[model samples]
Target: MLANMGNEIYRKIEQVKLLPLYTATDLTYLDRLEDILVKNNVRFIEVTFRSDLAIEAIKKLSQSNELIVGAGTVRTQKEAKDAIENGAKFVVSPAVVPEVIEYCIEQDVPVFPGTATPGDIQRAMEYGIKVVKFFPADIYGGLKAINALSGPFYDVKFLPTGGINEENFMEYVQNDHIVAVGGSFIISESLIKKDDGETADKALKSLIDKINLQK
Candidate 1:
């Protein structure tokens, strides 16, 4: 519950609005993602532990001083601990978990717990967190939904994911409350499957350029 935390995340978002999230195992593929992030000066990376090699991947990426690495799909307090222990500076989960929330707070690690409805948000607010993830963002009405929340939850900040993309990226990043977005565009399945390091580099840089241009 980082309710008191300001739009520092939005500043973080501005720095890394266009990011690549490697959500699965495949240490082999991350080499491409890392190369793109480095070559293009992309600012963030989410190395999700949805696979067997996540801890190893986090260790691998930790060597890079430029990347702000986070752990996505974090569910339990144990996973959160593992993420932080291994090198994740932040953690994000697709759903609200009270214990995990408390763990992050005590550990001083930023956690973006997901919420979709007003009730869900209220539940999150009870914990005193200001920043929350708008999970399945497109399914939850996307920007329109976020706009609706602004009236009642003006102080809240969001890191919209799930359906956020390059074509619709600006619509989210440009919003006053949106901190950033997490997606596969900068490192999509097709790109990874092909091991297209060059394409990934171009895409990551192009996305950064696009977002910065809008700013």
Candidate 2:
């Protein structure tokens, strides 16, 4: 039943097609940020554990039914448990951590482990994971790398993050193997730090427009 729940959450992510990576150091503007995301129709967000306030941010944001909150940059079973306890509906990690993956699966939470090579992808597949994160994508050859990896693992879908931005995100999203794109591009850290809701709103609207055009 937990596996089914994980699959359902994955489907929701695919439908939205954008996974905004958020890092919060202060909670002052979290509500405003949530408002911008909701107003733009974005349904999922990955609050990265890059900041000390990430778990707290997840706790606060997960309370809202308007968005599905997830924990990102998670690398341990302890972090996974804490994030989930605090209300994160899913977990994302920079690399494949067996313990973390096992914990998430046992708990039935969707997990996306990072992969940058065939070895990593194969390892994830061995663990029964169908979707994996392509990290530092730009440095690893970007879309070309993902396309190349697709040849051997055709059944696997990728969520390419790192160095992705508005100009190149569409290229990745258009690919058949891409489940969804993950990055800070849509709602950048700079924008958030400034509490610039207007700009963030415009960025998200533009992205939604682009996705609609593709459809």
State each model's C-alpha RMSD to the native: 2.2, 1.3
Instruction: Name the 10 consecutive residues with the lowest summed lDDT in model 1.
Output: 1-10
Write model 2 residue lDDT over 1-215, tens digit each, in one string.
44476788788888889999999877877888899889988978899999999999999998877889999999989999999999999999999999999999888888999999999999998878899999989999999999999999999999999999999889988999999999988885579666468878888999999999998
Question: Could you estimate the TM-score for every candidate?
Answer: 0.90, 0.96
> For residues 71-177, what per-residue lDDT tens digits would candidate 1 score against the true structure?
88889999899888988877888888888888888887778888998887887778777778899999999999999987899978777889887788888888887
Candidate 1's TM-score reads 0.90
For model 2, what is the alpha-carbon lDDT of residue 204?
Answer: 91
Cα lDDT, all candidates: 0.77, 0.90
User: Backbone clashes in each candidate structure, one number apiece?
Assistant: 1, 0
lDDT of 2: 0.90
